[model samples]
Target: MRRLGSALLAVSMFAGCGGLETEPSPESLTSPSFESQQAPITTTDVDVAPECKGIITFVNTATFQTLDAYLPSNVVTNLVNRRATAPFTSLADVSSVSLVGETRLKQLEQGARARGAINSTCVGIFDGLALSTSDAAAIVSLVNTIDDSELHDVLPDAWNGAANLLNLRPFTSAQAISNVAGIGEVSFRNIRNAATLSRPFEALAAAVNAIPSNGSAGVQLKRHFDWWNEVTAQHGYSQGGPTCFGLEPSSVPYGATIRPYLANSAEVMAEVQSTLDYVDADTKISPNVIAAGMANLSARTQGRSFKGCIFSYADDPWSRHNVAIFVDTVNGFSVFSETWWAE
Candidate 1:
């Protein structure tokens, strides 16, 4: 779990599962299924080029744009920005180390493989690191050259699609729209599970270190982690006060940096059924009204992410869950109800 060079560590060891947490909100539990999740694959031969030791994968914006030599790198921004904090330190730091014994990790792995068949919403697999499409393509191209294999052959197609969907930024009215259509939010869990994103981006570290000091990758990496820490720890809801503020912190200068880590339209559709559980009770009105209530609760509690999951109309109960509710550039909003999604 050590942070090597500019690359943040991405490995997962038995972080104490603080007792089966609590049931997801009623909206999240409508499906009535608790299939298992898979554990990530572990590898020792990550393979870093000796010549690429000084190369930095992330650039430090404070240093890069301002020409400051003392600032930390930007890679930390990416990690902290996404609200991914260390759930556990060394395996021994867990409150109940016995719960995460060898048997648990094995069970988690099997559960992950089995849950792969279900719809994306039903599967919450996050390895903690995600890549935009441009970034994915960049990595794919790198893999093809260094590992000599197709990215899909090594990673899932969903992963690729998610990546492309992530870097889809705002352009003028007359810009190209290829993968932008039907794009929703990319699941944070999926990106975290990438074979290349294994805990502790050591390979990436070696690569960055191989590059010259002039290379900005190291600085970029520092920003990414710092941002990630801020976002994950930030409150998801904002109160109306003298000044407007976001519930989450921003590591990346712009909100657009993390927009892709959301549920896409397809994934949003899949979650409609379960999202009902998070709705506020007072909003209830009809058949499957529970779902509607869940959505409402998710919208209010989970913040704007769920707001994107708006239904076609507000009155009809089923209609409420029919259409995906999205706002602006953000996608799937239901996942923001962390209280509902927890075990």
Candidate 2:
């Protein structure tokens, strides 16, 4: 694909499948059910001023060309010919391209529609880039402009309520938006099928990009945890000593960033269930004991984030899965066990 110079539309093609090399986790088996995903996106021709953050529909990838400084002219030529990348169906496909990266990728993918129209005149979606989460209202307002749109039904009231209350962060993929608010299964399916969602992000995409990743979350956790080095040093759990020391909680900064990409909260809720699983096998506890265990440890947070709390409590863990066990935060009297959600 690279030999043909296909870097024009959001960078070189990464694969025949949607962009990211990683496949949807085992949970994504459900994607096919709502998979009536159209090949070409659908859009209305309301001529929007670039200042309005209008959606630019690129009906055909095979003939699209742009000379703006995004990609080499030669690469754009290759994409126009389909000699390099396959027809881009969604941002998921373009996002996988190696060179596009998140910033430019968001701009191009959000600005241009796929397999739909031949729009050459619309907002220069990628003109300037900035990140922030306060744009959801404006973005939603822009989406509302899509006359006779179905988005209102798809996202629903409660989900929007969750968005407003939590000040839900901006998100890139339908997969990621599924993360924050209490957007449940039915809504998620409708969204995954909302193919045009790739383009009409308006200001939403910018804010989503601004939100931090798990990697950054991990970094902050470790930084705040510098205060706990004293506690870890005395218990033989010193940084890099035996267990969680110097384990780089920062490496998992995206822990909180897990919502959209997580696709669902069962993974988040699993944090609690995992503790139960471990307790079930590791200890011969009953329903009564399990209830008491949670009742006792639930208040131990001391206002710390779930994962890095100096103290860890396992209501009951079947075994460790994604969560990590360590004295990196704090170990309580070497009690039952210390467990926290690992992003």
Best by lDDT: 2
lDDT of 2 by residue, 1-343 (tens): 0000011222212233212224222233213431222123222111122222211123122233331244555444443444234545433344344444445544453434232121222222221211112122223333333211133323443446334323544444333444445565444333332322223221222222233444412111110112233223333222223222222334232111221111112322244445445334224334454454343233222232222222222223422112332221221111112233333
Q: TM-score per candidate, in order?
A: 0.18, 0.24
What is the TM-score of candidate 1?
0.18
Residue 318 accuracy (lDDT) in model 1: 23
In terms of lDDT, model 2 sits at: 0.29
lDDT of 2 at 227: 24
Q: Determine which window of 10 residues in candidate 2 has minimal summed lDDT.
A: 1-10
Alpha carbon lDDT at 245, candidate 2: 24
The reply for model 2, stretches above 4 Å from the true place, is 1-62, 65-75, 82-85, 88-107, 110-274, 277-343
User: Which one is best on TM-score?
Assistant: 2
